[model samples]
Target: MRLTDLISPDAVFATLKASTKKQLLQELSDRAAKLSGLPAREIFDALLHRERLGSTGIGEGIAIPHGKLGKVKSIFGIFARLERPVDFEALDGAPVDLVFLLIAPESSGADHLKALACAARMLRDPGLVATIRATRDHDALYSLIAQRSKPYAA
Candidate 1:
């Protein structure tokens, strides 16, 4: 369940400009719609409902907003680097600038969990996070994420 399995080059946005968490999710949902062929409104509504249960903000300037959709046949991801950090109600109370939005088929139970765990572990790497923040090019960001997500060589 590597990040590459869920995200492609086209799914990476290096500099997304949004003023609030809701705006960020909306933008991500719009992008996810184009990538996943799912309706943007449905995606947005699902994400909002999930957030109402609890904030996905995991601290250290990162947030993983995710949801399941009946229309999706497989898991999909969209990665974005915010142009400015915004309050996300993070547990640490820190603002978020890096976001990974994931959507999975409603029936993908174990696969969805594995993908989420893989993404969370990958983003927890401080070195990779720093590299991602240092670059503003979408291609570079995508390459960094994809390359770093590979299994570590012994």
Candidate 2:
């Protein structure tokens, strides 16, 4: 569940603008469509369905919106640093400025969970989170995640 395996430099956004969660999801959905070759509406629907279950926002100004798609052959990820924080209904009621969008195959139960956990672990580091916030270069942000990810970790 290494970050590098799921994300590339192009998938990283240095600064994204979205006034609301839905708008953000829509924008990401569009990008995911291009990257995954899936329909934007389909991806958006999947994310919205997952959100109906509960907000992916885990607090500390971060959110990880993810879902499984039947047509997906592999896991995909997109990371972004928002130009402005938006209300994400985070558990701690904090606005989300950093986000990671993950899409995986429907049958990838264990692999999907591992990837989600991997992203969570990476984002949970306060120092690293601070660094991600401070950095504005897209490639640098991707590198930070890639450098912090422990490939051997469970």
Best by lDDT: 2
Model 1: lDDT of residue 123: 90
TM-score of 2: 0.97
Which ten residues in a row are the worst by lDDT in model 1? 145-154
Best by TM-score: 2
Give the per-residue lDDT digits (tens) of candidate 2, residues 1-154: 4788899888999899999999999999999999878999989999999999999999999999998899999989999999999999999999999999999999988888888988898899999999999999988988888889866233
Cα displacement (angstroms), candidate 1, residue 97, comes to 0.4
Superposed Cα deviation of residue 138, candidate 2 (Å): 0.8
Q: How many residue pairs in model 1 have overlapping backbones?
A: 0
Candidate 2: misplaced stretches above 4 Å? 152-154
Q: Measured by TM-score, how close is model 1 to the native structure?
A: 0.95
Off by over 4 Å in 1: 151-154
